[model samples]
Target: MMPWLARSIYRAQEAALKRPTFAYWQALERSQWLDRAAVEALQARKLNALLGVALAHSPWHAARIRAAGLHEAVRAGELPLADLARLPTMTKRDARDNVDQLVWRGVPGGAFRYNTGGSSGEPLIFHFGRARQASDAAGRMRARNWWGVAPGEREAYLWGAPVELNKTDRIKTLRDRLVNQLVLNAFAMSAPHMDDYLAALQAWQPKCLYGYASSVALLAAHAEARGIKPRLTALRVVCTTGEPLYPHQRELIGRVFGVPVANEFGSRDIGFTAHEAPGGQMLLLSESHIVEVLDEAGQPVAPGEAGEAVITGLSSAAQPFIRYRTGDVLRLAPDAATGGQGLHVIAEVSGRQTDFVLAADGRVMHALAVIYVLRATPGVAQFKCVQHAVDRMEVQIVTDAQWNAAAGAAVVAGLRARLGEGVAIELKLLDTIPPEASGKHRYVVSHVPLPAGLMVTA
Candidate 1:
């Protein structure tokens, strides 16, 4: 199928199912021209409606709303933003435990089920409807416009495999081409493979390149070592998400791709949260999400003060995630909403970061690939993958009642499938898998150094 025709059909199908998506996109584009007050007021209206849905449909949210005494507000149809703060923050554990009660299967656009990638070391299946999908897609479309790239323009994705996806590569490639997008597997980013990816992107002439922050940086390092200078005529920007975009990574990616590198902040559970603007500010997609930065005591932090990222999905009626604790640390930019389009600004997002895993066959993959091996295993309460060499791995698993010999076999089989049968896997059951001295939980840690070609010269 021709890229243009395929994308047109895709847009049509999407518009049919998510009727309000393009309207929301157009509305958000107009909102950028409005003041911050207007944008947030719109958000407030949506938040109240979402709360109403929770009270009426979601058993878990209903219980929470009643316990918080907000049912009266729901009855009166006047749940203010302040009233929402009264409810307890929902944790990942809570989401996992209450999936049945929290999800409204009969959501207007219907509910689609999916699971998180477990990058947080905890995985859970959740349901999202067209509204959630529309918010993410529309929000991303707006952000791309900042760099002068429109939807349906050619783009490339350096992304990980979907958790437990059973697709054949041929079908995946065909889908990518139809959408005018190219995908370089982040799950298998070996040095040689990255060289090939660079060549493909240069030939594809994609207007934008979207990828994990570290994966792109690592590729840039490889390109410099191989002395392969690429000059893609149409490349406009490189948008990096999934993890924090370090300062050095931004510089390296920009230098290699010959375009500005933008940082994106969000997670699987919370949909799209924010994107970096052309003006060097990380702007929250406030139309879709109501983000609150809170201190350890759960009090709202002052602007510019770092706090945990507590988010509310205003459009998520299928599954209400009100005041959800995202675990990521961030702060509002003191100057957020001042001049640059009322989109709220994030000073920084202190989020997940992990090391790359080296496979026995000399292939290097994102840590999440190996982490998935443990994450999907039933016995794992928590797990950490430590690589001492290309072939040897130590999986430290905090086992629960679900732990069994079959769980052990499943873990080994999953790892071997990805890393190759030559790779040696050792399972170590633990009472507790503690964080590092820095108080950070690293799911995948590699002591092995990257080969000279893949190393970044700081």
Candidate 2:
């Protein structure tokens, strides 16, 4: 199937499913070309609308707005972004504790339940609807256009999402072929499977390769070790997500793939926050999110200084994520960093990193694979995964009211599925989960070290 034709057909189907998706996609296409002032104006309009909707439907948000004395300003569309600093910031704990109070479950298109295996300790199951979906899909489409890759173009995902890897039906296989997508499992990237993944990618000749930063770097390292240079003609850019892209990793991935590496900064909670531009700017999807870089004192930081990324997702009408603290440290880039693109710019975001979990069968899996296990398990508060040995894993959990005995069995099953049979899993319920000496919460700590020269981190 021709790439262009596949995109057309997929979009037609998407339009039938929700006409507004295409409308938003097209609007984003034009929005990117708008000036800085215009883009900020659009963000203000959307934020006001989001606040109004949240106040109308969600009593939790209404109380906060009213308490801040900004409810009148929010309703009158006169609230400035700076004034939002006066309001209390929303934490992950706040979202979890007030799920029912925060969600407008009966909004248009209906709020659908979604879960994120976040790198942060708190994994949340929340409700999202048409607006969030459109924001992500359309924003990604526009980002791809920057690299000359269109929707439905031949792209391979080296992802660990269970939903993508679990499909074994003939119908689903045919659908993938029609859409020009090839998915390689990053869940099991052993030397043997890495050889097979390389073969599949070579045969597919995808124009873009997208997946976990560490996994992609591991693949590139493996390719280098074997003295194998992949012969991919159409490949343009390799995009890395799921973790921070270290300098050496980026250099190696680009050198091996014969292309530039584009780093994407976002999490499961905040959908499609930002992507690297061709000019190397980390441009935020300002149309979808309002980002605030704050200092330790809870005030906005000077440009170029490192601070926490406080985000307000403009499209989260079904679930109000107003002034949400993402717990990520980042710095706002100056205009020079963006090439004057005028989109909100991020100089750098140093999110946390976890060591690779080694399977009993010599397979190396991304930490998120196990992190997903703890993240989706309800009733678990703060948690940690420590791979003590090949077959040994210790899970420490801080339970809230939602904790139950069945969650331990589910954890064992989930870990066994990824680490293989005979894997030892012990669940410990704790009063508090402590941070490391560095005051950082290392969600995953794999004591299993990689073979010499196999490490992607410095």
RMSD of each: 2.1, 1.9
Q: What is the C-alpha lDDT profile of model 1 across 144-228, one tens digit per residue? A: 9889988788999998875345668667777678778788889887777887898899889999999888888998888888888
Per-residue C-alpha lDDT of model 2 across residues 1-458, encoded as one tens digit per residue: 79888888778766666636668888988887788888888888888899899889999989999998999999899788667777789888788789999999888878888877555576787888888888888887788878989888999889775723344655666776777888787888889999999999999999899999999999999899888999999999999987889999999999999998999988777788999988888999989999998888788888789998999999999998988888899988767434455688888898878779999989888998898888788788788889999999999988888778788788889889889879999888899878888888888999998766577765
Please give the CA lDDT of all the candidate structures. 0.84, 0.85
lDDT, candidate 1, equals 0.84
Residue 90, model 2: lDDT of: 89
- TM-score between model 2 and native: 0.95
Local error of candidate 2 at residue 428 (angstroms): 1.8
